[model samples]
Target: MVNLLPIIKQTLLITFFVMSMMLIIEYLNVFTKGLWSKGIEKSKWKQVLLGAFLGVTPGCLGAYTAVSLFIHDIIGNGALVATMIATSGDEAFMMFTLFPEKAILLNVVIFTIAIAAGWLTDRFFKKKFYIPASDKHFHVHEIPECTGFPKNTFWHQLKHITPTRALMLMSILFFVTFITLDEHLASGSFHGILKWGHSSHSDSDPLWIKITFFTVISLSTAVIFIVNDHFLEKHLWGHIIKRHFSKIFLWTFFTLLLIALLMKHFDLHSVIQHNMFWVLVAAVLIGIIPESGPHLIFVMLFASGNLPLSILLASSIVQDGHGSLPLLAESRRSFIIVKLLNMAVGFSIGLAGLALGI
Candidate 1:
C-alpha cells in the first residue's frame, strides 16, 4: 500500500502541472495582446472551429474560462460552447495517465462527438438565440494594451508566474495526494470496521448513525476546499473547484454510501464484480447528475482498477460536471431540462460509439 503513495503523488503533481501550464498559457495570451479582442470578428464557422478546438483542452474550467471570455465579448458564445464540449474534464487527464491507450481512444471519440454536437447546436441557435445587432460590433484601431505585463522581458513573464502561482500548483498537488492517500486509508478502515462489526454486532444499528456519518464525512471533504484557499484562485485547480465542492461531495457520498450498504447487506461483492457493465452504467448515470468533482472519483476508481465499466460510463456522461452547474443554477427548470438534453445527446453518442466498437 505504501508503494502506491508515490504513484498517487506523481499523479497529483502532474495534475497540478497541467493546470498551471494552462493558466500560464492563458495569461500569456492576455499579456501578449493575443485574442484580446472585446469581440472576435470571425464568421460563425470560424467560431465553431475555435469551439471544437477548445473542446479538446483538458478540463471544463478551461472551457468555461473560454466561454466566459466570449460571453463578455472577449470571444463569442458559439466558440465557448464548442470549447466546452471539447473539454474532457480533469478526470480525462487522470484516465490518460493511468490507462493511456483506453483513455486516448475514449477522448478522441468524445472530442469528435463534442465538435459535431457543438457545431449543430451553434447553428441551430444562431438565428434565433444569438442574433448579432449592427451596433454590437466594436473594432479598435490597435490591440488593447496589456496592463498586467511588465515592460522588462524576464520580469514580464515572471510576474505572471509568481510565488502565488507556484503555491497554487503545489496546493493542488497536495490535494490530489491527500485524496488518493485518504481513499486507501479509508478503504482499509472500512474493511476492518465491517469485518469486526460483522463478527460481534447485531444487524440493527440506528439509521441515524449511518446518516450522520455519511453527512459529516461528506461535509468535511467539501469544506476542505475552504481551508485550501489556493484551490479558489484563477489557476487550473482553483477554476475547476471554485463552485463545485458541494455538489460533488453530496452526490459522491450518496453513491459511496449506497454502494457500501449494498455491499454489506447482500454480501454481493462477487455479483457486482462479475457484472462490470452495470457498474459502468451506474457511474455514467451518476456523471449526468451535474457536478464535476464527484465524477473525478470515477477516474480514481479507474486508476485503482475497481470498476472499469463504471469509470467508463461515468467518464462518458459527466463531461462538464460542476463547471456547467452555474449555468444550470440560474433556473431550476432550465437546468434540469438542459442537463437531461445533454445527457441524452451524450448517451446516444457514447452508445453509438460502443456499438460500432470505436
Candidate 2:
C-alpha cells in the first residue's frame, strides 16, 4: 500500500484531470454549437485549418468537437482527418501537465502535419459521404433558449440550476483543491507520475497550465447561462458526460495500476532497452484502441525517459484522439478509412524521427 500510493495518486490525478478537461470541452461544444455551425459554413480550407487547430488543443474536446462537426456534415472528411492526425488525444493533457514546453513544441509539429494531411486528403480524395439519415428527434444542433420567467438574472439562473451545472461547479472545486493538495503532497511535483521525467522535486507545470485551468473553470461556470436545460439534459451532460467520463476514468485507473504493478515486480527499463523496436511497435498498435486510457502508459513511459518523443509523436498521430468514436458509431467504413490515413502519416513521421535521430 505504501508503494502503491504514488501510482494511486497518479491515476486519480489523471482521472480527475480527464474529467475536468472533458467538462470544459463539452461545455464549449454545447455552448458554441451555433457559432461553430455558422462560422464553419465557409471554405473547406478554413474548416481544415480550424479542425487542425482544435485537434492540437489538449484533451479530447477539440477532437470530439471536430467529430461532431464532421458527423453533422458541417465539415468534410478532410477536416476530420486533419483533426485526428493532429490530435494527441487525452495524453496531451498529461504531457502538458508535466512538460509544457515539449508538449507545445510537439503539438506545433502535429498541427502542421494535420494541416497538410487534411489538405491533401481533401484535395485528392474528395467524395460525398452518405451519412445514413437519422429519424431520432434528439436534435443536437438546435440553438438553445433561456426559457424561463426571468431573463439572464443571477437569481433566475441559480434557481433554475440543472444537475449538469451543479456537477461542473463541484468538479471545478475538486480541481482547485486537488491541485493545491497534490502540490503539497508531492513537494511542488504535484503529481507522482509527473515526477517520472526530469526527476526534479521542484518541477511543476508552467504558468499557462494554471492559467488555462482557471480560464476553463470560468468558462465552464459561464456555460450554465448560455446553454439551456434541454441541451444539458438531452445532450451535453446526458450523452457525452454519461457516455465518456466513467469509461475513460476506469480504464485510466486500471491501466496505471497495471503499469504500477509491473514496475514493482519487473525491470521495465531493462526490458525496453533490450526490445526498443518491439516496444515502439506495441505503442503504435495500442494507438488503434480508439480509447484514451491505454495511451497513458505510453505517456508515462515517455515521461520516464524510457521512450522517444518521436514514438510518442507516432502514437499521437495514429490515435484519432477519441474523435473517431462518433464516426465509429455512425459508420465503420468512414472510421476505418480515416484511421488508415492517420496510421500512414504516423508511421512516416515516427520512422523519420528514428532515422534522423530527432
- State which candidate has the highest lDDT: 2
Q: Which ten residues in a row have the lowest lDDT in candidate 1?
A: 189-198
For residues 30-56, could you state the per-residue lDDT of candidate 2 as single tens digits? 445445546775688888998898788
- Residue range 192-289, candidate 1, lDDT tens digits: 22231234244433454334333433443332322222332543344433433334344434434444455446544466467645655665577665
> Which residue pairs in candidate 1 have backbone atoms (N, alpha carbon, C) closer than 3 angstroms, thus clashing?
38-73, 51-82, 55-86, 55-87, 70-75, 280-309, 280-310, 291-322, 292-322
Models 1 onward score TM values of 0.54, 0.78
Q: What TM-score would you give candidate 1 relative to the actual structure?
A: 0.54
